[model samples]
Target: MPEAHIARTGPRILVFSTNPISDPGIDLVGSAHMRYQPGVVTIPVPCSSGIRPSWLLHAIEAGFDGVFIAADGGDCAFVPDCTTRTAKIVDTAQKLLTEHGHDPQRIKMAAICSVCAEPFVNHMEKFSAALEALEV
Candidate 1:
């Protein structure tokens, strides 16, 4: 019997993560020996809420299939409403994507804690699948 081989066909993704929380969680993905797409790249930021919407759009225009924002949520040391502010940023980016004739769903935001390696991997897999479906 021969085993079937599966190839990864998803587009590359850009992740903007909060250094205090989501960054550690992303690191845990490696420490746990989890496997995500090799094309997944992460950029650590002081806070997800501080990311300008234009940056997200730029990522897409730069040929990334998707962008994910790992927000600090309520665990942000810098702000009380991290989730809300981050969500607003995502909303603005989504609109920008739409204005540029792209699908807004190409961008996503989620609350990822420092210990959330599994969740982060799950999100990556799901986002990759979604992007493949989009074929953009």
Candidate 2:
């Protein structure tokens, strides 16, 4: 088979999606033919609250222009307080970015539901625009 080609002409975003919640929504964005930036990528985790702050920093250090946490919010099956925990994670990650001389705005978080394809695509577009504006 011919090698697949992906155009990387935009801000790169690394997304952490909760497996039981946001992941399905992100997947639906593709399966439903919703359009988003080509540089957007995703990794599914068991819970958004479980994401390590270091991972967010690593994504930036590894060349991703921004990191987006697709939080499970109140829909998390694994943790009742997942939204609160994830918010703390985002806060810590933003502080870490700031301490490293990176803009705290490079990271964003939002709740995405199981069938929220349009919202996911919208978030990606807006996040990509915001990252481009940062121009770092």
Candidate 3:
């Protein structure tokens, strides 16, 4: 792929997060001086459920090694079934990735509340490691 041929200093990650829930959690990570891969990039969305499966595919093709969706879960004020809807989105994206000859595990989804800074950091660490292992 064109993106693959581009040189990168480290694995790139794209994080899609909900504004009310996951965004705060991500901010907390910085406020608390938490350590995670600096290459992890975040984009705040109104809700994770609204993300199109093609967007995830585009990210991978654009050179992102992994994609992470930080869902609002039970804290979602927009939808009662936010988590379920988000999961379905991930599942669809995973299927598409597999059909395109990519590993589905590169995409992941998790409920991240306002206080989930630690969890977010941990997830980033694990995901970065997973991508590194894929290079082996």
Top candidate (TM-score): 2
The sequence of per-residue lDDT tens digits that candidate 3 reaches over residues 1-136 is 6666855566799999988889999999999998787789999999988999999999998889999999999999999999999999999999999999889988999999998999999998888898888867
Q: What's the true lDDT of residue 61 in model 2? A: 91
Write down the TM-score for model 3.
0.91
Least lDDT summed over 10 consecutive residues: which range in candidate 1? 1-10
**For model 2, how does the per-residue alpha-carbon lDDT over 1-136 read when each residue is reduced to its tens digit?**
5577655599999999988889999989889987887788899999999999999999999999999999998898888998999999999999999999899999999999989889999899899888888995
The RMSD (Cα, Å) of candidate 3 is 4.6
Better of 2 and 3 by TM-score: 2
Whichever of 1 and 3 has more TM-score, that candidate is: 1
Q: Give the whole-model CA lDDT for all candidates, comma-separated.
A: 0.93, 0.92, 0.91
Question: Candidate 1, TM-score vs. the true structure?
Answer: 0.92
Question: Which candidate gets the maximum lDDT versus the true structure?
Answer: 1
Ranking by lDDT: 1, 2, 3
lDDT of 1: 0.93
